[model samples]
Target: MKRPTLSKKIDQLIYRNHKSATTNVIGCLVLHAIRSEIFERFQRAYVGMANKESSELGNLPTSPMAERARTCETTGERLRNRELAYGFDLDYKNDPPTLVPCTWSKNYAIGLYGRIGLQCYNLQNGTNLKFKRLEKHSTKRTGRYSSVYITLDATDPATGSVCSFQTQFSNAGSHLRLRARITWLTFAARIKQIPNEPIDDDWDEDTPGINEFYKVPLPKWFSDERGSKKYYVPESELHDNDWLQLLMEVAFFSKANRRLDAYLPLELNSVVVETLEDEPRDKLKADNAIFYISYKCCADPCSTPLAGDHRAVVRKTMDGKPGHMCLEVAFTKEQNKNEEE
Candidate 1:
């Protein structure tokens, strides 16, 4: 009969030395793995104990057979009594992987096209001018909105100096005519991870607003946990020490579209900030100050504009509300035709 494999032979030996002096290569490899933190608590309890080590320098007894017997006896006792070390609180194989919240920030600027200007609506004299406004929307349509207004750089080309004039009409108007033709420019946003509270329960995928926000699907291994409020996954789903793999997987599955280049889960605020100078500007900013406002989009690059949720019109609130700023931009036929093209 063929000789049994070294591992099988070692298992039969059970760490006990045979009468013939022979080395236990299989046993040594196992002991080395234990010492390297491969197992939860085995190394700390049985490592370096008398008669347990494979080498003679481990204070082994004079008799090899006796030393082997002692090693197996002590190890067996520990294993039978269920005293295996458990370093982790949850089961390594079963616990849900935790995702922490994080924050990211970027220095953003909003400006109109270079050498482009809008027809001065309220000015007594028609002067070419441009304007930019920071708009914030409300979760509830109480017909209220807010804006952060900044001074526009509007001056006559002949003077070669910026000028300022006060008028009652809103500078936030559509249609910024350009003196020169503009080319398409691409931009990308920077993402950083921060620490935030983890969700043990299921995250609500059925939430109304979230559906419009998140576009990517969850990972295949994710479990809904019987209609809970969060996504649950095994802690061991990703290989240990494969941190980059984990990050990429999360980013790939995140609903932020490819607009999200990176993700950091262990951050503090879970804040997402995109600057006007970043990649999403094309989808979020005005095209020559005359295009419709775009809403949340999917990751499919080939998807049609009709497939997107188009928030084509903007309206300013007329109600005398101190808390919100409501402004409106009507969708023109020209704009609609341009969107279709």
Candidate 2:
């Protein structure tokens, strides 16, 4: 009897192992079927060519046959890489955690004091605009952090826009400092409107709109440690402006075995603000510029004392006041204690 098709064989194997099979077992069967199908196709082609060779001269393996085998091997390697990149490990039957992008606005800023909130204004804006969160294991080390990606989307007041980005967080010592790297794809074009002189090498002819990246070092006081550090590292310069979109990669570092309890700011005061003079008398009227914001919260190390999904939100305000924006975090209450301290 002809050998069963790879699909049929896989079905039989699955049925047989259904009762006691683990995820790894299923993955093995699936991979086996894939390899078998490829090998079978190669064999069929080889037989056809061998038959032709016999008709013309004599049955023999040609150089082309070896090349075909090499190609099949290369294809298998690529499949394996793809499987690993996608976190498709069957050995650990646990369902892979779903990765979802998180966006948070000023409204979600919780438990932050006035001084701390002001420092995160622009960073929060960048976060709320367009951000993504993924549980990324450190390729260099065993520790894991919630990798958050962000992109710049300069939407017109009437027309809305969306983009994808990332932010990463880790623990340093007693302080939690965040490093934000922005990737601008289409939003680079909007940078021209700003009066500030663009860096000489900001954009190139072949460069896509604002493919620039920036690293913003968050204040150290935001961590459990009170304002210990005087100043943070300077923000990194953006090198490209050809891309229309922007990306922000933020890394939040805290003490070992500790989660970040700080909140991001929403007001422009944190970075820049415009002052207005009252009409009747020489009075100053200050208002917090409002902007749309959204975000989500997640932890890393996969299995830790306080690891799970956290609260995120999007909000807007017209008040241009300078103050703290609090967020209601949904993680361990101990984190809140850190904030209060």
Candidate 2: where are CA atoms >4 Å away?
A: 1-64, 72-158, 175-341
RMSD of each: 25.8, 19.4
lDDT string for model 2 (108-178, tens) is 11211111222233333432222222222211111232211111222222345543221111211222222
TM-score of each: 0.17, 0.23
The 10 consecutive residues of candidate 2 with the worst lDDT sum are 241-250
For candidate 1, the lDDT comes to 0.28
Model 1 Cα shift for residue 2 (angstroms): 99
lDDT of residue 148 for candidate 2: 15
Q: Ten consecutive residues with minimal summed lDDT in candidate 1?
A: 184-193
Model 1 lDDT tens row, 125-181: 234333322121101111121111122334555556554311111123232231111
The global Cα lDDT (0 to 1) of model 2 is 0.27
Give per-residue lDDT, candidate 2, residue 313: 12
